[model samples]
Structure formats: C-alpha cells, structure tokens
Target: MTRLQPLPGGLPERFHVAHAMEKGASRTRLRASDLSAPFHGVRSLSLGEADTILDRCRSYVPRLAPGQFFSHETVFVLRGLSTPEWPYVPRIHVSAHRPAREPRTHGVVGHRLQTREPAIDVGPEGMPIENAVRAWRQCGRLWGLDDLVAGADALLAGRHPIASLGDLEEEVALMGDVRGGILRRSLALARPGVRSPRETHLRLLLVRRGFPEPDVNVDIFSTRGEFVAEIDLAFAAWRVAVEYDGRVHAEDPRQFARDADRWAAIRDAGWDHVRILNHHLRGGGAPAVAMVRAALIRAGWRPGL
Candidate 1:
C-alpha cells in the first residue's frame, strides 16, 4: 500500500480547502484524517486549537462573508472580556447588518444587527468584530442588569480597558429605550475603574442594599504621601474598604502573603477593611452586604443619613 502525499509546506495550519487544492495538493491528500473541517470548505490541523472559543472563531474565519462579522458574547470572548459563558453556548455567533441576511452556517448562530463600519472594529489579526461599545449595547438584549453592568465595567476598567465610561454612556444615550431601556438602566448603575466583574458584583450588591456606592479600586495613601494599595471598593468618606477575596489569593502562598500584608497596611492606615468571599455573593448577597454595612458603621456611618 502507498502512503498519501503530504500537503504543501506553504499552506497554513488553517486554510481554505480551495486554496490548498489550488496550491498543488491532490484531492486524496486533502481528504486525509489529519485535518479537520471547522467550517464548510475550511480545514484546521486538528490540534488543540479546537479546545478554545477563540480558536474556533479563527477556524471559521474563512467562511465569514463581506457583510458578516463576530458579535455579542462571541466577540467578548474573542477579545478577552469577562462575559458570562451561558450566552456563548451551543453555537458561535456571526452577524450582519440590515437588508443583509445573517450567516446560516452549521455550528454558527446568526444575528441581524443595526450596525456597520466604524461600529465594526477590525482587530489586530484582521478579524472584524463589533466594537466593544456596540457589542455592549447588543448584549443588553441578552444580559440582565448585573451581567450588563459587569460587562460594561470590564470595558471601562482602568486595567486592560477596551473603552472608556464615556464611550458606554454615549452608546447608551443613543439607544433610546431599546430593550425596554435596560441599556440606560445598566449604565446608571455601572461604574468606571472597577478591576473585575466580581468587584462590580460586590459594588452592585452594596448599592442594592441602599448602602452608598463605594469608589471602585480606590488608592489608599498615608499622611506621608506614599501610596498604600488599591482596594477593590472603598467608602472614602467612611474610610471603609471592601475587597473580593477569590480562591486564587488563598490557594497561592505568595499571593496570600501579599494580600495579608496589604490588608494589614490598610488597617494600619486607620481604615476598616472588609473581605468578601464567593459564598457571601450567593443567596442574594445579604451576608456580604451586612459585612460592608458593619464596616461602614464602625467608621461612624449612621442609618438614615
């Protein structure tokens, strides 16, 4: 028995089948078990690339038409935004504008949108996607108030920011009661400078309990003008700092030590520190809210003020 001829060396890991055929590849060689078809007429090397959402999107790029681009939570995942995973299940998203039909590919979900260029951002690798602001607006139709605000806060977050708070506000202002005004409502609750979605959840939990909105990622300073640390949420007037303590800090020895030192310094600076955990966020977040309220009271915050 004779072995099949290998594909041309110049071909990429993921390439159009027609392109590979045009590049001096025989039909039999292209049908081999080594390559997997991620989309019709597209083949990937079938490595670990299929394991992630971003890789799956890239694999489908060859099938993307001129009017179609990525949208919703798919673009969020592609761009590394912290969106809920539920929205991304079952099928990858493909989008187009008015008058043009959305994609109908297998393993793809089509979205007919009211968006075009300028609102569409072509990323570094040349993958066209809805800009972060427009995607946030589109997401309003899918996410609830908490997930919506959390996604926006991530875009406006000081670290790895995709857009500014002003960017979100501008998009929301133009939406004009779309999705029954959830865009505007989420914007009213969302804050800039939050570090993570967990921090956003903590802030919203406090505000929902009628606690005053705390500053997100506030910097602490000693009287000597030295920076202490950037606490997750801070009540500047009340001198209360609340932080979300995830498992990473507890499981990693070095990170745990640094967190300990940071918490100690905040206390030494005469501030009340509240540490919130995942359990506190469950069951309506009453426990975490109570903890923050106690810290506020310790710093002289009175009820009905």
Candidate 2:
C-alpha cells in the first residue's frame, strides 16, 4: 500500500484546486490522485468556471476506472434548474437520496456527489444522471406544493388555472417555498388559457416584493351578486380598483370608450379606481407599493405589522 501526498492545508488536492481556481486562477489542470480522496473528491474539480467546468472534467471520464464522481449540485446546474450568476450557485434541494458518507465540503467551496442511483450517466460534461435527477426532483416538489394548491383552489371555485408564469413566480415568492415556483412555472407552460403574460409577470413582481396581494379579474356585483363590473386587480377593503390599461385599451377605440364608461360606473358605485399602465409595471414597483400602502393606511391600516 502507498500513502498519497495530501493536498496543501490538509485539504484534498481537488478541493485545493477548486479553491485556488475560484480566487481567479483561469488555467489549471488536475491529475487523478488529486481526486483520490473519500467519495473520489469530485469537489476538487468544481472550479466556478460555469460553462466549462464539466467540459474540463471530461478528460478524466475515459479514465474513471471506478468510484470516481461529481457533485449533485453541479449536475443540477448543468441540467438548468439554477442559473449561474456567480458568488452563489443555485442550491438544488434533493433530500430524496441518502448519502452513505458525508461530503468533503458542505457547499459551493467543494463537495462530493452522493446519490442512491446506481451507475451515473456520464458524457462530455460527466454525469447527466445527477443533474437530471436533481432537476426532476425540484420540479416535482414545486408542483406538489404550489400548483396543487392553486389548481385545487381554482377548480373548486369553478375558476380557470390559466395564470401567467410571472404571477406564479410571485405566488411562489410569497409562499417562500420551492414547491410554489416549480408548480407555477410548470402550470403556466403546460396550460395556455390563464391571464396574459405581462399581467402575470407584473402580478409576480408585486407579490414577491412584499406588497399586499391583489385579486385578479375580480367581478363586482350587485348586493344580490348580479355581475355589474369586472376589474383587473382590486383591493376591495380600500375600495381601490386597478386596471392594467394595456396597449389594447388604448389601441381599440371601442375598448377605450368602454373603459371610460366602466370607470364612471365604478365611480358611481363608490369604488375609488386607479389605473396602471405597462410602463408603470416596468419602472416603479416600490412606488406602486408605496401608493397602495399610503391608500391602505388612509383607510386605517396600521403601517407596521
């Protein structure tokens, strides 16, 4: 038996390699022994080079005699659940598979891939199995939480689940859970009939930014519940009704005229109406929240919760 030379700072050579690379070493390579630590030291190979880290690792794929591997998060990134924005790589939550042993580094610094699946699928980028499994798992959790709740609510109320992806994002942000974002994205892509894309995105931004959630397509009715008017988003308590006032509203003469009539009717019925345009959504979320907050405050909402 031979004792391998331990990497500097008592870290595995791969870990050292990854650490050094992250601190701005543009060009570096590793030998097999550098990855010979427990769990085959896959973390050492993870140098933060976003697009090419996997590509660089392919050189050793043909040499993966046995037991050598990559990290699970790395696999997920390659598959696309998380975008690489530098500093913090998107964390993939995969608690489904149990690891036989602990990883060398707990997070982005360096870590090993521990999965229950037998025989990882390797390619030019190494294990596609890891990325695919993680992506699928995240997607499942997302649908299980957000989509199921929203879909069930919509169905029971006899409402359509055809909402925008942006709106789904906001709902997910509000719930502060993976389940929400996943289901929202999945449902929006699969179903075609929900709110328009822009409206959905605006809805999402509003909710994610800690503003009070607004009702979508709220129907104002008579005291007998006979439908009298329809509004895009409404804060009934504040009597604040908001319309998207989109390009269609301005482009179509009939729609423009009808909108004026509708606002007048809403005013007559004692609702304070506020109209928003696409540009407002694009520029001033904080202002929008402030305006809404101000109105809600005037209507007797305590400022600090």
How many clashes (backbone N, Cα, C below 3 Å) per candidate? Answer: 0, 5
lDDT of each: 0.81, 0.47
lDDT of 2 by residue, 10-109 (tens): 4333443355355544332335433432223343434443345454344233323344444344444443323323453344222223344323333222
lDDT of 1 by residue, 270-305 (tens): 789899999998878888988988888888898779
Q: Point to the candidate with the largest TM-score.
A: 1
Cα displacement (angstroms), candidate 2, residue 167, comes to 18
lDDT of 1: 0.81
Residue pairs in candidate 2 whose N, alpha carbon or C atoms collide under 3 angstroms: 14-44, 75-131, 142-179, 162-194, 167-200
lDDT of 2: 0.47
